[model samples]
Target: MCNNQLTITNPRYLKYARITGNPVHVYSGRDDYRLRVPCGHCDDCLKRRQQQWFSRAHHLMKRMALRPDQCLFCTFTLKPSVYEQAKEKPYIPIRQFLDRLRKHPRFREKDPITKRYRYRKVKFPYLFVVEFADGKTAAKRGRVSTHRMHYHAILFGCPLYWWQVRDLWQGDVVDEAKGWYTGMGKAEVDPLESESGVRYVLKYMTKDCAAHQYISDVDARKNGKLIVSHGFGRLSKEDIKIMRKNMLRGASSWFCHFINNYRYSIPRYWKTACFSPNEIRCRNDSLIPGILRDFVKKRYPFPDFTFQQQQQIYNCLLWP
Candidate 1:
């Protein structure tokens, strides 16, 4: 089994909740929601963390580790609803800026393609904040580069990485196209359609619980379900079924769904740091794709890989 536990040994985790009637309200950041007993949220919060629950318990614990939610891939913040609404209402960010553009004598669209594109009305549609059920969205990131995951690509759109690389934010995607990145990982995107007529790509990051990264479609008429990656490590199909069943039972809000969605991606990133004696063996053995394997060579110390390992990397990047 993979070790997906979050640490919470500090009494600090307990403080995350405020006791209320039968349902405990597990609170984090500025949000609160209902949960049942064994209330892992509560247990991790109050009970001294048992050497785990560290990251899950409190962002403060990391001291050095910035909150994962702050990262672009985790894009827990940013409201696409607001931005879209402003566009719909003709509410420009600055009246003067709009006026200047409007006054230009030849203001009509010149490009036939641009003019052919008709606009649609989207209320409270900031751009993309994962389509909240309640119509509420989080604050947008101050800068495009710093936008969190959901907010990152929402403003642009989720490519779902039809390519070999993954980008945390829309701003970063351009750079990726130009061959600039820390490293690239690929995975097939499974679109989990929700009742709300929306679809989300769920996957766990290397060091985070599941996070909602992409929303493929949305229809206001239906409720939505989260789309998560297929499997992780060596779990048998039965194990995955059991875990999914348990996860659904304990799930409370969209947050739980986020974890449920990407639960598989987390452990797969864990490597022993060294699996071969000689450098060539190690480089050839890495899970990175042959296309990307060149990366390990001049990019970083080569990690070993075999033909089978190369195929495995390809399978992951090309996941559905």
Candidate 2:
């Protein structure tokens, strides 16, 4: 006889996968239109974390009052060719393009108004942010497959023409015959709209959240990388990296805090039930029996909630 009580204390854990009739405790949470099993490493959890960073970044842009009318939104893509198609990690060229953009005189120039005199040049120190999204398109018959490494970038500074931006990326190359020079591929530029439009631009980057895809795709890890920024209150490369690390650490701490303050009580029907650690592993399907599932469903309408809500409910002695 299993004498272990199954109790749920953490709201972060949405559901338990049922592997046996060992009487496991499970919680149901709504993610989008369907119920999701939320583990710390699940795709939904990762997407939520990434969205937090995106929201923070958006807030920072608003605080700075970055005018989108003066900004440029550009998409940089790698060209399709025999040599380009042969590469495994296609995003390597995208990284090189970003490095070149960082070192480019046009990008590094910070003189706000250097063109005042005849001997001066126009200076535009601005913020440059880029997000990576999968461009992996399926190849039809007689077509070659490529990773389609690309980036969507927002340049919060002087306006630039489409051809000018393309040429600048092209100028990064020294050898035209090696095909490395042609990797600049296609570059598209357009004048940015309002703040809401900026969000729309970033929307594509967060579309499909596939944990396995992220691990295998070369472009996935570059989603939040800051390409270049030269102006007042600019973050250096190291600072950006540190800030990202801190953000992830902060998320982990939130879960830990919740876990520390969590207290679980056994229900009346399962007064003697307790779960062993070795038997608490994830499995498919529901661990809750039909009767208990109906009982819990009638009591708690939703199982998913934030840590703060969990703390509030605990303080109020609310459990279902």
Best by TM-score: 2
Error of 1 at 86 (Å): 20
Q: Model 2, which residues run further than 4 Å from truth?
A: 1-43, 80-145, 158-162, 171-183, 204-208, 211-320
Candidate 1 lDDT over 24-127, as tens digits, reads: 22343322132222322222222222112211212121322333222222232223433454333322322322233233333333456666533232211112
- Quickly count the clashes in candidate 1: 59
Off by over 4 Å in 1: 1-73, 76-130, 137-168, 172-223, 232-320
Q: Candidate 1, overall lDDT?
A: 0.27
Per-residue lDDT value at 82 in model 1: 37
- Weakest 10 consecutive residues, lDDT, candidate 1? 200-209
* TM-score computed on alpha carbons, candidate 1: 0.17
